[model samples]
Target: MTTATAFDPMSEDYQQNPFGYYRAMRHEAPAYFIESMGVWALFRYEDVVTTLRRPELYSSRDWINNALGEFDPVPQVPSIISSDPPDHARLRRLASKAFVPGLIKKMEPGIRGLISELLDEVQDRSEFDYVSDFAANVPVNVTAQILGADKTIARNEFKRWTADLIRSGARSVLPQEELDRIHRSVNELRGYFTELIAYRRIHPGDDLVSALVQAEEDQQVLSADEVLSLTFIIQFGGAETPSHLISSALWECFGDPALLDAVKTDPDVLPLVIDETFRHVSPVRFLGRTTTQDIELHGKVIPADSVLLSYIASACRDETVFAEPDTFDINRPGLSRHLALGMGPHYCIGAVLGKMMCGLALGMTLQRMPNLRPVADDVTWLPSPWVRGLASYLVAP
Candidate 1:
């Protein structure tokens, strides 16, 4: 086994929250080799920022390659996340135009309405599973409205399917039976989207689905397969990641009565609080990329074609970057430097939308259900190194 693989990143210690091990890595092994996985992890802020900026040199090729190519290998829906340029460039251009700032802003009112209705169910109840009752539904519903899909159908099996996808990333190397169900889900999901795309083509509307379908009708648009993949990407991507981030952030806030009250009273302070929570408990703990060429960091060499995982969660807590790094203060200054959304061209495309949606979801819940509280159960985290979030949170007021 190589050095990187020696320390299992998915261990309960790391999975519970990896700040401790990552902190050790920053000092004792800033660019330490993992014997088991045969990769290097750069835990410090400087190395992460530098690595993210030069994607051409520190390539995203592997993530795209493994994700779409080898990860599942079942041919149902394919996404651009696993493709390389010029294909990557082509798909990204179309998507960037689709997600332009003005276009995203237009959905705010509709998103707010969707949030209001979802929380409406919990208004009369004393306790609720924050993950399912509230968090899981908001993003998918908001996305459905944007895509002109039925809000009713959008909520169906959202939690289970997305959970399986996250788990697929984890069991990529484990017992096959653990993730066998995901393959069937993927096929069903693809066919579900395939029908939706076809319907949108025949009868276009103002939703995103219609928009993409029109793109195909008007010109040489994205392939049918690309549409299916990006649609799933938009649905799951727009939904799962931020939904859990919102949950984790709330867990931190409500978990602390003092912090919870502060945000409740000061409405203006909520946005900053949300942003800071993301910096501290970023939804994605780590992501891997291959080195396109040899590079140097902290005086250590990273050879070409080598795989590197940047621990953004670790970078946010670097002592040199922020004061009292371990403390979770929503009001902390300069928390923006955290690489939660990553850096450079390949940075998360849905970041702005994700932020708006998450902020709206949390803001509405707090405003509507100020007394909401989680039940007495250990928060079960999603099983994946790629995404860090709870599987569910049972709560009561």
Candidate 2:
């Protein structure tokens, strides 16, 4: 097996900008083994796709659990993203009903109004950290709206919980205090959802959580644990990814003068810009998978039970599949093939909602502020192994 140069995802250098490392790994060792993490990372698009397509051979039962450090008292149940076939399929099918494109489209009017309101709050300011002032707020509020928790939970409180929950994935490398905070966040989410689930039983509302609480198919329904598991993942997933996506799109556009000019001139290019941002700035860096059987690729044999990390961020920038992979080109024809939202049966359930939020937020923001631009040349990236997003993106209007 090819062993890549000391690969530590926890390193600050790698976390800041992984594209350079991804580029080297793609060429030198497509399937490299990281000794420290005991994981074989697939950097090539072909290899990543092959592994993602065959979940039976490469199970997901413990992938997310391994990525997100396990809690001490709280048992990690198999959620949709962390379950293998049959169970995964069942969970996805039932959970997906709440996220159907039609249902998400129904949320468009409300989401647009929400975005407008958020923009209004920042309108008078000459500059604002888009990540905090706007991007961050959009997803949590949308998630609250979806879960029917808007009225029960305050916006700032929900935002705080979502931020802490997303960090739970980095608990293994985090400081003791930070780790404890993440655990608290986990407990809070569990407690909140546990109570919400119980309350929803009495007062079912037209929200995703309520729907999942009562979701039934083929005379089979999701248990309370199942509902909690799905809600936990969906809550954060729905909150974190889209926020990063919106900020990343703005970052790319403002940084590229020509792209920004084009966008300003032709508003229709906004969708293309967002799609390309998904490829250029993949929010979720990589997803872990456990091998069910021996698999040979790139002249190496990966043993069963090995933690295989498919760097979808790397796959999205695979030179073979994407021409000028590093360059952010909105017109890239292969935009449809990017694995930012993931691939296979475990694809993001909130994909439709995510794209809509991004497009709406960006389109509205740019339209409202004709002179929007970046406040600095550099961005503060989130220092985490699981995602690639700005810690704060300062922008001026």
**Best-fitting candidate, measured by TM-score?**
2
TM-score of 2: 0.94
Tens digits of per-residue lDDT, candidate 2, 88-144, equal: 889888887787777787888988988898999997898999998999888888788
Model 1 C-alpha lDDT per residue in residues 1-397, reported as the tens digit of each score: 1233335686665677567777778877788767666788888898888777766776776764444344343244335665546667677777666677887888888888888988888778767778877787787788778877766667775556666676666554647776568776766676777888899888987677776665632366877877777778787777777787778878888767888887677777677777887787888777677888888777889899998988888898899998898888876778777788887666788888888888888777787778777687477786556677777887876
TM values, all candidates: 0.87, 0.94
Per-candidate local distance difference test: 0.74, 0.83
Cα RMSD of all models vs. native, in order, equals 3.5, 2.5
For candidate 2, the lDDT comes to 0.83
